[model samples]
Target chain A: MSESYEATVTDPVSAPMTCDSNPVEEWLRMDRMPHIWCPGCGIGTSVNCFTRAIEESSLDRKNIAIVSGIGCTGRVAGYLLLDSFHTTHGRALPFATGLKLASPKTKVVVYSGDGDLFAIGGNHFIHAARRNLDMTVLCVNNFNYGMTGGQVAPTTPEFAIASTTPYGSVERPFNLPYLAQSCGAVYVARWTVYHVKQLQRSIREALEKPGFTFIEMVAPCPTLFVRRNRLGDGLAALESYEENAVIKNGADTRECDLGMGGPIVCGKFVDIDRPSYLSNQVAHLRKVLGDRYVMPDAWQGVVQ
Target chain B: MVETKKSAAPKAPKGHVVINTERCKGCGFCAQFCPTGVLAMSKGFNLKGYHPPIIADAAKCSGCGLCGMYCPDFAIYGVKNGRKPESGDL
Candidate 1:
């Protein structure tokens, strides 16, 4: 390989031994380890950055909730120690919106894979961004349906090989950032696993921001996506990310579509403040009721 | 946002990583992500028949913990003098 890291080596098999405390254990469900992800899968990298973002954001852990849809990345909600919900496929966004509206104070985070988010749940995604719900959606775009054995997905780069697309995919891929921006998402960013530091920072920013926020994490599915395509192992995918990703903050979202092979643009494409659903509702109520409608908290006290 | 001190030396602290060898799946993430390139897949194999990474040079480690962040299995973490490397204030 042209890279300079020690990624090409394999030792002879040996007997098992005991392991010790994991530093990230506090953020994880210990009984779940070792996780089901392949040795070099980048999902773990996103999880690491997320936990770090939580730690760095200083948000109250009890008030933070994670919602995930069914997929390989959907397993993230089950792995996290926070209050998390493993929702049905393509439903994490709507589920998170319910949670956010119910408790407004809680920081809801939607974590799921591209297949779950873009393929089936895509409708909810656009509407949520259009309404500007107050929540953060983190999508791990592995470019295929990872849990379903590498089927073609909405985010799979055009012409990439998948189980369903044995010869090559003849479909166009979604430019996620452009979709989110056009739908009025307030904060949007994209990062690959190779950009861990920047990814963590962007996640932290997403967590702290208001209104619908979306961050796309480009990770490797070495087991299915990589192997099926003859791409090298997990680390090789990471090396590719390092080599091909170009960081351009504030780049136009329309130009961020990814392809099978080429320079992948990464950046914070959008960040702006706008009235969220809750805030707009509250404002409308205040203006229309003219002091006749009591605030929900006060009304609850009266009912009790 | 709190600003981190820039007065500190740019070099990372001298650190060592603890590889939970048994848990390692021989991904080489630690070796590949370490900024100082302080680790490498060793000739020895773990129980899973995967090659676990080993510290190639203690002096070269910066204790930045990128390996820990990149590690999908959480089988590795960096420690400097028995404590974690300093993190920016929350």
Candidate 2:
């Protein structure tokens, strides 16, 4: 089957250009070329979707601010030539929220890892969703802590073995989409690296959304996770994702249970319009602070 | 002067990166390594607060496979334009 599929996959050289019209390339940080992800890692796939979405949206790089946290995924902010913040672990969202509130015109995005968001930063995640801040939160779930070595993470499945869980992880994993919906995120969706086109479309829509948006991407961890679990190589893991993932309409987080041994659900889980935190804050300030909030006397003043 | 008819150029082969989530831990390793500025972390937590890596650009992959190689979890890989070289033939 692998041989047959390989035979059918298009050759990179002859494949039709799907990304030519994307304008983000003009501002790509080529100096950061040869990024350091391991072979067969899915973060590259996620990156592809992100750039495509930015290109399709035709967003101005000058008006965008990409923020990230600690771990491999957090490096995205540094790689982009646009204004970015390579911040502390599990704090990408908070920083992004501050940026969005300070500059309502700028499009702030927080890119972070599972451990950063779910483990240490779980509280921040829920608040960000509840507040419905005007920002895009893209979470890259790989299953274990890949940077500091593969340890059992909050998303690690029950009975999955990790460095920390030598006998297999007994803890249950969190259902991301359901959590986002319940917390009031305006937009929520899940996509794997395989569905590149759909991923790009969803991202573009999420970015255009007026309120907080969350996209959970299912990527592979062939090195640590696969090696620890003995799940073969990167290609084999991708094949597994292709086999296990089931695309269904109106799928929600409640329906997905990593411990249940069911089909992996993938689709646009939710999209709704709500009052953004930034807009609400501005309104509150206008009502409360009023003229008492004195404007800075000078745009760029030099104190004598 | 003779008018020269301009022809549309052939499109370049577009490459992309893909992730296998079941094998992913949401480690954010790939998000850190993408050179073309395409990947990002998900805001929501997966079954594990591990918000799997997402592809932000399907077209800018350049087929480098750097993320896949650097991924400690090996959750990332490349989908090139052409078929894989036949086994025992490469």
Candidate 3:
């Protein structure tokens, strides 16, 4: 907490309610009201679910750290009243990994857009999940890169009209839950902003989960994605999600492939138990090193 | 997407919604998906020149807080009269 804006990002449960009427208002940086999210953009709604998820998760706010990379959804880190890291483009996972290693007690949540997470940061995403790090990755998939005038992103569905794909996208979009589940993530889920409560609950579940957890939030980008594709405005996109999204909890991730305006099989696709990376490494080291072992304190008593 | 299944509303008013017109972007998600049809788009516009949602039928609200959850601008929220279904969405 610095003198930059006389507000502290700590202990939500104990802090006095500045905006008693709206509970989520406490978690937001009120000074930054009327965020940059477009009029019909679903990012704001996604953020609402996130703040509510954090509250309902009942986790210690002081120990939770939010990390994000460059993009439209990447701006989420700056708006929330928390210890957040706005890292370089496609570097959010790396920063989050380092943060988790340095402060093992901290809950690292990497919240970024599809382009940031699945495009440039794609390698980091798989590797982090492969190691099963104790972290949560919330990827907002709006089908295309909205901020940069609707460029075709890694998650852009086939036959979609993006700026890069003028006629239609010929490339296949990434089935996010399948990627995370195959990479050994302990928990994986997908939900649209239309399913706000479900998305919030899924996020809370991911927060409480031990190993690597991945949740893809399907949000609509009205300014870029929606308008460019002629899918109507933000409300029309939400309506499509309402019409197409099917809730099938415990469904196979393989069947969750999304096409251009097709059935979106959404649910908790994967939930499996496995030893986390750090704890396993620590246990192995302690056994081999015997009495010579000493725990590493990278934060060096400054973070707490 | 889960709010479509409509059961009969309770006899008495369940909740009331508060709207901050200034921040509303007038996406109309709240009014369209309100399960009980509690809200409608206001004829007037905010400072941003976007029409905000107004509570049209106060008695029909079920305190589900779906409007608050669906609201992208954080401009409106429903306050339940008593305990609510699933609670926890302001």
Candidate 4:
């Protein structure tokens, strides 16, 4: 289907002269095309999957709100052309929870790095998942604090070297999918940057599913994490993930922990249905107040 | 475009690649993971001094956006010559 267009397009010669635009161009703020993430960082790849998922869902874009905490991944909110908020460190989940509560119809997404989600906001993460808030939480775990210059983080694998832990971190890292699963997340999945298609598909699935959905994206931190650990460049890091990652959909979350180097189990670990925080509240209020209860306009028919 | 179902040789998937050279940070992700080896890093550097991937063999392209999927910078994307938005039919 070669046409006359130059290097940028492959449109047919007889096809209508539609505007030349990349699929992602429409979703992003063009002015921020060159994001701050260093070359080979996995955050950009995750963003690609995210845009694709949003497009696939066919949801009203205006009704979706994205919130991010302070970190390299937090910059995503500024890049996407949507209602986004770059909240304080570790506060992204709470902000997203409030957003979901205020407007039940709006799709709230909390995207942040491991440091922000697990280190600073660990309590919020556990509480939100326990409450089964209706929101999607994407934790881009680079293993360390990338923005703070390669410091050790809560998700840094045990025995991994970081700036703060030159002799190797002794603390056991949090197994993200396991944590999410135990905390009562409705959906739990983990994927490295190499599993772009799977990550995108899971994000899409999480977006549509009600209640708390948690996705752990193991992206490369080329500038800090990779360089500090002598993990070659970003490409090498991604290649390592490709080589080591084992797809284990429906695997037990207990076995899905990452060591310094070994088989990296990646898949959708848990998917179960239950009453969401909002849905449960609405259901109980209606039963107690009977005819006197006034159901919120958005949740009128969503009692169950 | 002539409809050529001519079944003897399976029609190879066609793809269009749009590269923003200036936006590229010279990451070899697109070239390294192009499944079909349709791209290779160029010898010359962009203004940013990074060697962006150039189309090595355009004909081998299947229009799978894996290159775009792995790309850290929004420097490159592959578009399948589908009728319309069906290419990104994910």
Which ten contiguous residues of candidate 2 chain B have the minimum total lDDT? B81-90
TM-score of each: 0.89, 0.69, 0.89, 0.91
Instruction: State the lDDT of candidate 1 residue by residue for A113-182, as single tens digits.
Output: 9999988999999999999998999999999998879999998888889999999899999999999999
Please say which candidate is ahead in DockQ: 2 or 4: 4
Error of 1 at A27 (Å): 0.5
Model 3 score (lDDT) = 0.85
lDDT of all the models against the reference? Answer: 0.84, 0.71, 0.85, 0.84
Q: Please, what are the lDDT tens digits per residue for candidate 4 over residues A1-304?
A: 3221224433344222333355677778888666788888889999989988898886789999999999999999999999999999999998988888778888999999999999899999999999999999999999999987999999998888899999899999999999999999999999998888888899999999989999999988888778877889999998999999999999999998888877899999999998999878877887998888887776655445
Q: In candidate 4, how many Å is residue A89 off? A: 0.6
Q: How far is candidate 2 from the true structure (C-alpha RMSD, Å)?
A: 12.1
What CAPRI class is candidate 4?
A: acceptable
The root-mean-square deviation over C-alpha atoms between each candidate and the true structure, in angstroms, is 6.7, 12.1, 8.1, 4.0
Q: Name the lDDT value of residue A34 in candidate 3.
A: 77
- Give me the runs in candidate 1 sitting further than 4 Å from their true place: A1-19, A298-304, B1-13, B82-90
Shift of residue B66 alpha carbon in model 2, Å: 17
Candidate 1 chain A: worst-modelled 10 consecutive residues by lDDT: A8-17
Better of 1 and 3 by DockQ: 1
Candidate 4 segments whose C-alpha is farther than 4 A from its true place: A1-20, A296-304, B1-13, B82-90
Q: Ten residues in a row with the worst lDDT in model 4 chain A?
A: A1-10
- List model 2 lDDT by residue over B1-90, tens digit each: 999776687555355665555345665646665678656766544453456666665556676655554444434555454643111110
lDDT of 2 by residue, A26-126 (tens): 44465674466766777766876787677678677578899989888887787777798999888888888777666677888888888888888889999
